[model samples]
Target: MLLVKKKGQGVKYGYQFLRMRYIIMADILFEDIFGVKDIDFGGKKFLRVSRIFCESESFKMELLLDVNTQIYPMELGDKFRLKICTTLREDGKPDTGEFNQHDAGPSRADQFEYVMYGQVYRIEGDESSATDTASTLSAYVSFGGLLMRLKGDANNLHGFKVDSNVYLLMKKLAF
Candidate 1:
């Protein structure tokens, strides 16, 4: 875990009221997200996603995707990708903490860079469906660029705006 020493009383006060923040670097692999039921959060309903490269030993986790807001949609399954960094834990378990404010630094491209281009095969739930011969869609996009493209059936064509700063690291590394 990463820690910052307090320099003054204000720092101590902040720690007492605010939570300590940290970031975790690890590999993330998309597995699947098949079952989707409801959207309890007043958005695009809830979906179950299967992940293999998660830092957590549990192996699988679910995220709530707000289809309405394209800014940061929860990992719907193997469909969504991950961008991570590395840090050590006291017990030896991988420290996979959320990227917090204190963790801000240079862009991942500055350290490493790459591009990921793949077809979005499926989008489980009532939202959308997969199309085409491979039943897969092809997309070519740069990790540190502004727009990522998704190509498939004209009916299924779409684009997702990525926050390069947040996903740049994981996008560069191969799964």
Candidate 2:
């Protein structure tokens, strides 16, 4: 299912109109963590390690989380629930389909906010990439069912792999 909401729309209509294109529900464990220090990107502060690579040994698969959130709390050996929600686009409208105004409801804050609960499955430094003091090269992680991908700097995720469980909050700012 996919949710396409225009600016200033909400759930007054119903859930049938607001569906998630992708939602990953699973339990995860943190295996490793890495960080690169202060730098500027697009006028914003960022760290070295910016991506979370996850794998499921039993499933024989891996997923990557590119997060943009700053200052996260997660750590090795920690466990938690993971929820991932993705819409077709930041706006409620489809690129090729006709949009129905009736299907759109009031524009509420909840419509723009995304929240997920999960644990740190695993975190490992990326060995393929060289680590520099200015930044991290790469890292790896794993969980049972869910994962999230964001984009930001490594410092933004500093001290993230320290907590047992974490709540991931995101908001779509595009129109």
Candidate 3:
């Protein structure tokens, strides 16, 4: 159940590589449709900074994120699909793990209105964290100090691991 998409028709890896199989259904590490519940909670403020709290549509996960509103403005009623993935390559190739602003080629980030590159720095479990489900887990990511906390079930956070390079892609949903 981890994402490890490999190319080559009619090919398979050894049992030792089962953890890195072709992820047909789940292309990315984590995905959730989040509805903005509140903005500027506690009046926490800094120049060009706004903290937005959101709740997931399907997994019931909660996200408290700090985004630079100057670059990517979000409204009080904004609903978006937030995705955390290992690679931005549409072909599923892993990222070079280097920062190359002029990297040639089309990326998955092109379709999204907002994107950020970050890493999963921590993960913890809290038995009482989730009210709806029995499972409890949380993944913390930082996009250059703009932090994100995703808390919900462990199954929803399957592929996430510490030090994993990730891309946060967001696209607004129109009703």
| Candidate 1 per-residue lDDT over residues 1-175, each given as its tens digit | 3334567733343442233232221212122222323333343233432112222112233332222123332242223333332222312223344555475444333443332223232332222443333343333333322323233332232222222121323221222
What shift in Å separates residue 66 of candidate 1 from its native position after superposition? 24
Clashes of each: 5, 41, 0
If the candidates were sorted by their TM-score against the true structure, best first, what order would they fall in? 3, 2, 1
Worst-scoring 10-residue span by lDDT in model 3: 16-25
lDDT: the better of candidates 2 and 3? 3
TM-score for each predicted model, relative to the true structure? 0.20, 0.30, 0.80
Cα lDDT, all candidates: 0.30, 0.35, 0.84
lDDT at 18 for candidate 2? 38
Which one wins on lDDT? 3
lDDT of 3: 0.84
Cα displacement (angstroms), candidate 1, residue 42, comes to 38
- Candidate 3 per-residue lDDT over residues 82-172, each given as its tens digit: 8888888776667776758777578889889899988899999996655655677889999999999998878888888999888899999
lDDT of 2 by residue, 1-97 (tens): 4445566874344455434321211111222222222222224224523344433333222335544345443333222233232212244332233
RMSD in Å for model 1: 17.0
TM-score for candidate 2: 0.30
Model 1: lDDT equals 0.30
| Candidate ranking (lDDT, best to worst) | 3, 2, 1
